[model samples]
Target: MHIEVAKKSLQKNNQEVYNFLIDIKNFEILMPENIDKFEVLDANTFKFALSGMPEIILRLKEQHPYEKIVLGAASDKLPFTLTVNIIATSENESEVGLSFEGEFNAMMAMMIKSPITNFMETLSKNMDKIA
Candidate 1:
């Protein structure tokens, strides 16, 4: 399944957003309020846990300068990819979009579709504040 979240216009330029995201620690600023634990393993890896969810680790898979950042779960158990794309709408502004890609069975997809969509929307909406 693939989900496209809302696109947000950021006050920061594409390079600013790219610089912030390339550093894993900055991700904490966009985390949910009920985080249980957070850890930065390195520049490219970080792990966090929500109130009742298991800790999930994410790693920077690939980054294309100021254009996009590709990330994926560090563990094979959680097979998913997240791509953050930045479009420079103007010299001082940028449009940000996030896409989540995962393979899920029918039952699982049905169960998670709504929540994941909401999460993605919230995440994209929140990025501007942190950028």
Candidate 2:
């Protein structure tokens, strides 16, 4: 499955966005159903455990200190790669764009899509709040 989302935020620039990303890694908060745990591995990397599910490993592929951050996830059921790029439009305006693509078996695809979609939506909302 593939999903893309773009949103505008009031954040100043890439630096602010990068800081927000770091905060996201540390925050224990969850979106919908509440994630079981979130662990920060290092700058730009983390591991996540979703509620009622095994841990999903996430690795940072590329990052530009808020300008853009790309992440890849590998798991038992659905393995996906996603890139999130944040662009500064002005001193106090920015936009976030996300692109996700992955291959999923038929059975897992159906079950995972909805939740992942929901997660993305929640993520967008969270980013908006920070912005």
Pick the TM-score winner. 1
State the lDDT at 91 in candidate 1.
94
Error (Å) of candidate 2 at residue 23 is: 7.0
Q: How many backbone overlaps does candidate 1 show? A: 0
After superposition, which runs of candidate 2 have C-alpha atoms over 4 Å from their true positions? Answer: 22-33, 74-78, 129-131
lDDT, candidates in the order shown? 0.86, 0.70
TM-score against native, each model = 0.92, 0.77
- Global local distance difference test of model 1: 0.86
Worst 10-residue lDDT window, candidate 2:
24-33
Tens-digit lDDT string for candidate 1 (1-131):
99997789998999999998898898888776777888999889999887766788899999999999998999887589989999999999999999999888889888878867876777786796664
For lDDT, the strongest prediction is 1
Alpha-carbon RMSD to native, per candidate: 1.4, 2.9
Error of 1 at 27 (Å): 0.7
